[model samples]
Each structure stands twice: as C-alpha cells, then as structure tokens.
Target: MNQQYTIAGLDLPDINPEDKLNRILSSALEKTNGYLINKSTSLAHYWDANYFNLDKVQIFQDSTPAEQSSILQLCNLGILEEAYFIEKAGMGYMAKMILLAETISERMLYGLFAADEVTHFSQISSFLPTPKVSYNPFLDLLENVVESEDKTVLLFVLQVVLEGWGLTHYRSIASCCQNPHLKSILQGFLQDESRHHATGVTLLENRSLGKSSQNIVEILAMFLQMVQLGPQSVVKAVEQVKGHLSKQDKINIFAQLDTETHSGSRLKLLRNLIDLPNAKNILENLEMKGSFQPLKPSQCVSFNCS
Candidate 1:
C-alpha cells in the first residue's frame, strides 16, 4: 500500500491556544496558570509565569555559588536556542506543508503541528531576561534538510529523525528540571512531537525508497555528525557569559553540560531508525557499502558545507 495510513479520523485534541494554553502550562508544571488572567500584567509577568525560578529548581538547590552561576548561564543559552530552533522549524514545516502535502488531512495536521511549534517558540522567547543571540547548529542542519527537493526525504529527516531526537531530548531535560513551568512546556512539546514522529514513521514505511534510499541514508549520516559535533555558537555563548569563572569552576560547568550525552542519545536514535522493519533494506545496502560507521566528535563547519 503506497498510502500506509490516513489520520483523517484520528481523535487528536483540538488545541485552542487561548483556552488551553493556561491549562496545559499549569498542569504540566504543577503551577497555577494565572499569569494571563489579568489584562494589565506586564510582559515580564507573562514571562515569569513560564520562566524557571532558579531557587525553586531542584538541580541548583545544592550547588555551590560558582556552580549556581554556571547553571544560570547555561540555562539562558539553552532557553534562547530552544526558542530559536522551535521558531525556525515551525516556519520550515509550514512552508513544507504548503509545498508538499498531498492531502487535505495531511496539510491540516502539518498546519496544526506548525502552530504548536510557534506557540512553543513564543512562550519560551517571552521568558528570556535579556536579548540574547547565538548561532544554532541544529537549526542550520534543519534548514539544509528543508531545502531539499525530495519531500519524502524531507519528511523522513524532519518528522522521523529530528522530531524523534527532540522527543527524547526534551523528555530527558524535563525529567531533570526542577522547575514545574519549564517541565510543563516541555511536556506540551513532547505531545505534538510524538504525533509528528509517529506520522513520519508510518508515512515513510508506506513509501518505496527505490533509488533514493542511498540519498536518505547520507542525509541521516550528516544529521548524526551534526549532533555529535554539538553547537559551537551555543558553547561559545555560554563560555562568554561565564568568562569570569575560575578555571576549576569552568571545568565544573562543562562537566554538567550534556553535549556528549546528547550526542550518544542522537546516535542511538539514528540506529533505531534504520533498524525498523521498513528500513531493513536500506540498512543492508549501507552495510554492504561499508558506509555504516560511528561518528566521532569534531569541530565541523556549518551543516551547509558539502
């Protein structure tokens, strides 16, 4: 069956941001969603409702003074980049839906997914303390994938691979975060990402790879490498913010960072992706060509490099 499944009658929740945003935010974070109730509230109040109160987060409760400072810097960098990537991906998905979706239902689903991404971006951006700017490696990689002319490959990359990685990463962060507000937001994102990943898997399973399997595999390799390398700009930004820290304090902060751990997780996700029933043939072809190799960490140029 070329069309593996249809989500036409899927009983997915109709997310009305106005009515449901507060409920979703409050429930996930275990906090009251009362920030938006008063029309006269300042932007900071709205942001504060979703932002983490460092004193309240469990991870930093027992840390030393230097460690607490480092964590705050890291959180700032993480939050800004998270917002940036969500916005970038949301825009890309909207564009792809308009250009490539073959059915009305598919288009509708993508539209809703895009809307959710924007909502996430907006809420996260609101929480920033200052205007922060940094380069995002993963977002750059996603742009490359979106530019490809092959819609199937695009779907596989964004929905299946990237979103799958996102689901895992978000869950990991949310579980460790002591702040209920951020945890709630991450949960909301996970819900949408799960749906997107499932749909991508089904769509890819039903489609024939034909001659494009090799291309798809190569794209997957590039994505894995990007993950392993981590984001240079974000690292640099964090370093700049923590420039005053002593040498040992710097070491402590880096130790707490999860760059290597995330790389390993992403690599595992890639392996599982190609091990799926429908992906067996593609995997065999790559293995025969001796192209299946583990990526090592290195400082690489932007993802747009050939």
Candidate 2:
C-alpha cells in the first residue's frame, strides 16, 4: 500500500490490512474519486503532446525544430503548473465562500462549486511533472479578497468578473487543445463555471457597489495590470530554451506574437465581463483610463516582471 502523507484529506488513505473500518472508509473514498473522475467527463484525461501551433507565436519562426519543441514543452509545463495552482486556488476560494454563505441556498451552490474545483485540481495535477504549490499573483489576490468580509464585493469581483472572464479563457483553451480528453474536461468544467458565474449575476444584478466602489476599482485595477503584462509567458519560455535575450530579440519575439490582436481581443472580452448595469460608472471610469486596453508588445517588453 502507498504510504499516506496526510492524516486528513479527501484522498483515500492506506488502510490497516486487518481493520475493517479502515477498509470501509478506503473503499468509500476510492469510489468517491471514481465518481468525480466520471463526472469530469472521462477517465482518460491525460496530457496531449500534439504539436502546438506556433505559427502566430513568432519566437519559434526561425528556431530549429528541436528548439521549438523544447520551448513548447516548457510552455506547456508552465501553463499546466499555473493551471494546477489556479484550480487549487479555486478550491480554496470555494470553501471560503461556503463558510461565508448567508443562506442555505447559497451554501448549497458553493458546496457544489467546491466539489467542481476539487475535480478540476485533480485532473490538472495529473498533467504536472511534479507537484508544485507556488505563489500566483491572481491566487494571492483572490485569497486577500476572500478575507475581506464583504459578501457582495466578493460576489461582484470573483464570480461576476473573474469567473465571467474564465468562460472565455477556458473555452479558448479547450478549442485549441490537442488532447481530446483534457478538452472534454475543460468543456465540462466550463459548464460548471458558467453556472458559478450566473450565481453571482443573479445575486448581485442590481446591487450597487455603494461604499465598496473604491475598493472594487482598486482590486480590479490590479487585475488589469496583470492583463497588461502580455507575452511574458512566451518570452520567458523562449529564454529558458534559448538563454538570455537582447532587448531587440525580446521585441522581435513580441512582434511575432501578434500582440495587438491578442491584446485587443482580451481587452474586449474583459470589458464585456465587467459591463454590468450596476457598474456603469465604474466601467466608464476604467475605459477612460484605458484599463481595458491590451499591452503593446514593444512597450510591455521593456517592463520587467522580475
């Protein structure tokens, strides 16, 4: 039997061979995970290494095939690691929301959401080379908001805005993913995410930001800043495989990324997400500040994320 690392968790534990109670609990846990896997739409949710389309990525344009392959793998690993942590972060926020649920119905919705997040975490973790739980800017921001003791603000920002954005984010990944099985999971997960997002829309539809407007704008601005950090992933992936790049190299790579198109599409989708009726004034203010504009690769290339 595999040794148990955690004394308490939803994971099936190593049972005492002779302990009937332990065996029963282990059996139940095994079945639970089995159900969750099926609920995720398939049991063969493995990572697919199908060739990544780099035609638009530009960095791979002049690279040798082997170099391109290396960068692709690194990029995939980074994306999966980030997804793993982000989904884990989803579980964290869902659990917190369950505790913060003001009504039985709200509690039920969050309970279901928590289960969905755990399933996503399990599936994404299978794609990782090794387990990692590192800091993520979005995750950190999410954790802070959960601790902020305002349910309405939480709903508007997390569910209404972020999860609303996730519909497009997850759908885009699913559409382009080569792995049929993982694509199915992403598709299924999006359905749940859609419902989770709807919960916020239904709950806060007409609720004014009121006293929370300033805090809401500040939190949202941080998210916009993250949006402005474009092509960083591609640049870093290239550097990892090709070593230190000159500024010109970075700028050239950024140009190849078709950053204008990426930035425009992303900013447009983001604007639509937060354009709620109750947030009319906030939306106008954000638009005025160009908070919804995507970053220009040349300008962003010089901005050091480190």
Worst 10 residues of 2 by lDDT: 1-10
The lDDT for every candidate, in the order shown, is 0.55, 0.70
List candidate 1 stretches off by more than 4 Å.
Answer: 1-71, 129-133, 230-262, 281-306
Error of 2 at 218 (Å): 1.0
Per-residue alpha-carbon lDDT of candidate 1 for residues 77-179, written as tens digits (9 for 90 to 100): 4654565455545655665666578888888887776666656655554445433334445555565566667877776767777778778877766666555
Expressed as tens digits, the lDDT of each residue in 184-285 for candidate 2 is 878887888899999999888767789887778888888877777665776787888888988888877777776666667777788888888888877887
Give per-residue lDDT, candidate 1, residue 67: 60
Query: Against the correct fold, how does model 1 do in TM-score?
Result: 0.63
**Top candidate by TM-score:** 2
Clashing pairs in 2: none
| Sequence-dependent TM-score of model 2 | 0.82
Q: 5, model 2: CA deviation in Å?
A: 18
Error of 1 at 75 (Å): 4.7
